[model samples]
Target: MTDEFASLNHFNGARDTPMPQDRLRAIRHGAEALREQLLDDPPVHFARSFDLLRIPYPAWFAFTGVYSQQLLKPHMVHLLARMAVVQYDDFEGRLRTLLFTPADFEAGNETPYFKRLAEKTPKFLHKAIAPVYNTVPQALASCGISPAQVDYITYDHLHTQDLRRWLGTPGLLPNARLLVHRQELASVRGLLPVQAEWYCPHGLDGIAAERIVPFDGSIQLGRGLALVHTPGHTEGNHSLVYRTGDGLRVSSENGVSADSWAPLSSRHDGIRRYAKATGAEVILNGNTQEGSTDQYLSMVLERTLAGTSSSHGFSNVVPSAECSPHWLFPGAPTSHLWGETSFGTPLHA
Candidate 1:
C-alpha cells in the first residue's frame, strides 16, 4: 500500500497521549466490528466490470460502484472503477455486463453478419463468463458483508446500474433521504439514455460555487460539529471540528500530510485567516503523527497571530489574511499587511 493508503491506519498505536478517549474508542470500535463481520466470510470476489460495490453507510445514505472491466463500450464505467481503487479504497467488487444486442452495445453495424454475431455472442461467451460472474460474489463472502445489505449501486456514472442495484435491494433505507449534488445529478441525467424518474428531496442543499473561498463557518450534525474549510487541496473541501476539554480542534480531511502541518499551512491563506479569526488552538489533519493534535493546533494559532498588526496598534493580535485565490495558493505573498488598515476587515475590523 502507498503512504496515502496506509495513512488511514496510522493512528492505531497512539493511546498514551492525552486526547479524547471516547471519540477515539468509538471510531476504533466501529472499524473493528465491521472488520470482524467481513472476516466471517473471507476471500471476497472481484467482478470483471464492476470491480467493487461499497455501501459505506448501513442505513443506506450512499452506495458506490466501480467498473473494473477494460472493455471499449463502457468508458465511464472504466474511469470510475479505476478512481475507486487508486483514489479511494471504498468498494469491494466490480460488475460485468454482457451485451447481446448490437444496437445496445454499438451505435451502428452495417453488416448482417455482425448483427447476428452480437446475438450469438452471449451464448458462446456465457460459458467463459460464468466463472467470472461468481468471482465478485465469492469475494463479498470473504469480505463478510451480505449482498442483501447493499442499498445503492453504481455503474461508473451511468444511472442504469444505480437503478439495477436499487431494484435488487428493495426496502433498503425506506426513510433515509438520497443526497446528490445538483451538478452531479444534472450530469448523470444528461449522459444516461435511460427513462428513469429523478427526484430531489426537500433536504437537498445544492453546494454553492463560492464555497471555494475559505470562511469561518460551522455545521452542526447529530454526531458533532464539522468545520467548513475552503482551502487544502480541493475546492469546496471541508473538515470536521471536534472539541476537547483542552481546547478547540479541527479534523482536516486533506489539510496536510503526516510529516508536518507547516507545509500545508504555508500556502493556505484561508486557513491562516480562520485560525487568526477563531483563535483555534488545535488543528488535526488526516495524516499526522499521533498525539500531536494539541501541539499542532497551538503552532498554527501562534503562526497566524505572529507578524500581524492590530487595529489598536497592538502587534500581538492575529493577522487576518485576504481570502483571495492569488494569496491562498500557487502565488507569492501579498505586498500589503493585513490588520487594522485604512479599510475595515470582515473577521476583526
Candidate 2:
C-alpha cells in the first residue's frame, strides 16, 4: 500500500476545487480502503505513547460547542503532550525506528510565545506543572531505547516545536532525519500572525536541508507506518498512522480527546448536545480556526482511518495532546484517554 494512495495525498491543497460534502464522501472511501489494506499485514514491530507534560489551554479552544454560554467563562483545560515510538522496516526491508512528536520541552520553552505564557503562570501553579515534565531523552530511557537508535523524527505539526536542538548543530539524534511536510517546513520560516503564537521564532533555522525529508501529501515510511496529510489543523498538518496489535491508530494535535472525534458520544458539557443539535460528527480543537471546515472534514478522515476502539465506542484516534482528567479542570474530563500503548518487543534488548 506504499503508493496506492498517492493521488489522494495532499487532498487539502485543493479544498476549493470540490464541495466539502463531496470531498468528505471521497475521504471516507479512501480512508476505509487504506484502513483495510494496512491492518491485514501490519509491519510494525513496536508502537507506544509516552507522557511528556501537561499545559493549560482554553476550554473554548479545546472544545468549541454550538452554544457559547459555557465557553465564555474563565475556564481552562489541561492537555498532555505525548510522544510516540514506532519501529518498522524501510522500503529496503531493513528495520528502522521513528519517533513522532518527541518534543524537547526545555528547548520549546525558549519560544517567546510560550515563554511569556510561562512567566504569567502563578509560582505555585508553575511548580505543579514542573513535576509532570519529562525530556525527550528521559522518555527514551524509560523505554530502554537510545537516541542513536532513532532513524527518523517527525510530528503531526510544528506548533510549539523547536527542532534546532534535535536536528541542528550537535543534535541529540545524530543519525535521525526529520520528516516534515513541505508546506509545514515553509510555514515555520514565514509564520502568519495566527500561527506565530504557537511556533518558535528560530525553530528550523540552520538545519541542513539534507537532514530534513520534506514531503507533500501522504507517504508510507514502511509497512506499518504512514503519515497522512490531514490538513486544516494547520495548512500542512499531517496525522501519524500506524498499525498496532489491536488495530490502526491515528495521532495528531487536531483534537485533544476521543470526544473531539466522537462529540455525540461525549460526556463533556454541551459537547454531546452541540453535536446532536448541529449534526456534527466531530468537534474542532478551535484554537486555530484557520480552516474550520477543512479541519472538520479532516477529523472525519481520521475517524474513518482509525475505525473504532473495541473497548471504547469512539474511534482509535490517539490525540498527540490528550485531555486527561485532572483537578485543574473537573468539568472537562475526557471520556477516553489513550495514556500509553506498547506492542511487540522493545527495539533494543
Candidate 3:
C-alpha cells in the first residue's frame, strides 16, 4: 500500500504496540494532519467519475442502539446498503471498473448468528421485521449496470456475507474478483468466537484463491478512491473512502448514524447525556464491541479523513447500514438519511 493513501494507524503488529491510549493520541494527530492536507490539496478525481446507489433493507430494532450502551425504543431501522460504481484509469492507463458493496440480501439471511434471533422472533412478525427491498444485482440493473461489467467487489467487512453465490460456486460476476484485507481473509478462514455469529459458516467455501485479491494495510485505487483499514468493528474491518462531489466521504459499519460520530449535536434522548458522562466523541455500533478502543480510534480516523459535513453536524462518515427514522422507532430518530444517492453518470449509459 502506498504511504500517501494508507491508514495512519494499523493494529496488525505486536500486541499493545504502544498501548491503546498512546495509539489513540497518535491517530488523532495523524487524522487532523491528513484532513488539513486534503483540504489544502485534494487528490486527483476519478477519470469518468464515480456513482453510488443506496438501497434500504430492514434491520433489527434493538441492534441499532447508540453505543449499544443504552437501549432505545423497540422498532426496526431501515438500514441503507450502498453500491459504489467507480471507473478510473490505472497506472497503465487502463480503464478499471469497481463494484463496491454488492451485498446479497438473500444470502445474508443465512447467517447462523442472525438465524438464532429469527428463530426466537414470533412467526407472525418475521416478514414485517425482515422484508425484501431489492437485490444488489437488481439495484445495479436499475442504474443501467450489468453484472458482467463489475471488475472488483468488496465490502467494509464481511459480516453476514455469503460469497459462494457471487464469486465461489455460482460465478455470478464473471470478471469480478474480491478485494479484501489479508487479516480479514484469515479471520473468515478461522472464525473467532465473538465474530463467528455474524458470519455465514460456509460463505467462502468454494471460492478459488485466484478470485480474491488480499492485501495488507490500506490501498488507494487509482486516484479518487482508497480503502482505509479501520479495524474495531471486527479485527479485519475497513472503511471505504471516496471523493464525492459534496466532499470526501467514508463508509463503514463503525457507527449507525450521524448521531453516532457527533453525539453532542444529536436530538436523540439520552445520547448527549451519555456522551458527556463518558467523555465520548463517537458512539459505537455496539452490535460487536470486539475492539471498542480500536473502533473508537478508527472512527476518529474516518471522521478526520472525511472532515465535517455542513449539511449535517458530524463528519461525513456514512455508515454502510445507516439507521432511518420510523414510526415504530419513534424516539430514536436519525440525524440524516443519505438515501438512494446518485453521483456522476451511470456506467452503462
Which model scores highest in TM-score? 2
TM-score of model 3 (CA atoms): 0.85
Residues 118-143 of candidate 2 have per-residue lDDT tens digits of 89888788757544667788878887
In candidate 3, what are the lDDT values of residues 7-29, reduced to their tens digit? 43433341355687778777777
Report each candidate's C-alpha RMSD, comma-separated, in the order given.
22.9, 2.7, 4.1
Residue lDDT tens for model 1, 1-349: 1111111231233333466454345434533442233223322122111222111111010101111111111221100111010011122323211110001112112223333434655667433321122223343344343444332221111221222112212422222222222333454334322112221121113323222111222222212112222222222223322222222223222221111123223233543444455444323331112224433432342223222223322122111111111211222222232221111111100
Model 1 spans > 4 angstroms off: 1-122, 129-131, 135-139, 147-156, 159-162, 167-181, 188-349
Model 2 misplaced regions, further than 4 Å = 1-16, 66-74
The models' CA-based lDDT, in order, is 0.24, 0.81, 0.68
Candidate 2 at 307: error in angstroms?
A: 0.2
**Global CA lDDT computed for model 2:** 0.81
Per-prediction TM-score, please?
A: 0.22, 0.93, 0.85
Candidate 1, poorest ten consecutive residues by summed lDDT: 77-86
- Cα deviation of 164 in candidate 2 (Å)? 1.7
Ranking by TM-score: 2, 3, 1
